[model samples]
Target: MGNPKQKWTNEEEEALRAGVAKHGAGKWKLIQKDPEFNQYLHSRSNIDLKDKWRNMAAAVQGSREKLRPPRPRPVQDVPAVPSVPLQTPTVVPAPVIHESPADHVKDESGKDLPDAKNGPRYTELIFDALKDQNAMDISSILAYIEKMSDIPVPPNFRKPLGARLRRLVQQEKLEKVESSLYRLKTNTVETNASNQKDTWPRPHPPALYTKVGESLEEAAKTAAYKVVEAENKSSVAAEAIKELEKFSKMAEETDSILQLAKDIFDRCTTHGEILLVA
Candidate 1:
């Protein structure tokens, strides 16, 4: 564990593979014994081999699971592995030398069909073209893409190639051998492949519970009905109280008027002035 937690670069990994291929598996000491064998991983040990293989196996298994859908398995199963080296070899893109600019490449109209997008882009095509060759320049790449592309070559294709190549170099997908000459980078493809990390497994939302008798709106309606009925009763009672108070005030006013009249009458009788009235 001398290099514990240290990420293995693609060059170091390739060296390990090449070492294993040259010497054979389970003979990491033979690969480590020779320094020139592992240029990037010369300091690695047999222990490193065991750890790296474990890590790679896990990575390959995980990658396969992601890329492929689950398939039905037979009840009878036999545990087997097809030569371990076959499992880990980098898939070299098949060489694409010729191009088809025939009418079949286009649709009914002159507006040509789309170039490769979802499967593989121009960059990948260029890399595949150069895989068997030594190196290539921007002119060579442009020519290749134009020939392979449908009917009419895309406008400003040369300008885009320069920019695309520069970007590829920046992304470490391609190496600039000279000023304009480029080649597919050996170490870049495998190193940052797992850069898009998987998100954490989120717990599902908590379950909600409710009684089955009534819905939320129905329950609210029932409560509102009770409140409205109580308010209506209270309003009727309040109106009755107000009517009683008004009647009492009128009776008091009538009593005061009668007392005044009685006083007037008593004074009139004392003065000997009694009148008969209808």
Candidate 2:
């Protein structure tokens, strides 16, 4: 009857995280001993601490493949953009094809979503979203898109959206006020093929993927793994080889944290026990 078995709050979770960081995850007892942690988590048992850690770990290190970054821009399937940079795009010229209305994206209900006839471009959606707001980050944009549900998001859509945004910035359709936060350019108009420059740019982006807080070494490793992933999906050995060369040096310096994740991911993949985090 003491605390009425209150649910875990964000504060308690943060304290537990601090505890784990101070004294590795295994030493729950030590964590509980420290006032930094114990003061906030006194009611919880060591078992609860361990279990919470397990849940957090599982969530963070979900599928092994996801641990590997996808290729930048759209190189076939894997958008190859880091969660942090989510770089826009590069000028690689390719034939631009506009999607048709008849081929509108269908939802799970098998009904055509709104604005399906128009080309389902990422920039269009983002531009539309920011029309009213000042700026937004990827998470907010993603959440907004999910909530609106006007357009059906493709599977693993983040990379593609990032790639599109990068292209939009390149085309001067949008501007990045911050790394993640972006705003519509004052001069920018509704982006369409006619308004875009005639010079067709390479649709694919560079292979480099660097997270904001992560070391360059780790970023390089992510790029290499991503290249491997791209090769696996598209069977484009030549392209993968080319991209792999870009990150050749970075892949060799795997830190302890990355090494541990790799080991766990590899083991889980082998056992087919890796489930996509829901």
Best candidate, lDDT: 2
Task: Give per-model TM-scores.
Answer: 0.27, 0.28
lDDT of 2 at 144: 61
Query: Candidate 1 lDDT, tens digit per residue, 125-214?
Result: 677667866588877776676666544343334534565566566667778986779987887455773232212122221111111122
Query: What count of clashes does model 1 give?
Result: 0
Which 10 successive residues of model 1 have the least lDDT summed? 204-213
* Predicted structure 1: lDDT: 0.46
The residue-by-residue lDDT of candidate 2 on 1-278, one tens digit each, is 56666677655665665554335456677767766566677888888887877665443333333656663433332212212123224321121233322232344432221111112343456766888687987666655665565554433344435545655676677788877887877774664754633232322322322222233344455555455444443433356564455334223322222422333444345566754755
> Which residue pairs in candidate 1 collide?
none
Instruction: Report the error of model 2 at residue 247, Å.
Output: 41
User: What is the model-wide C-alpha lDDT for candidate 2?
Assistant: 0.48
Candidate topping TM-score:
2
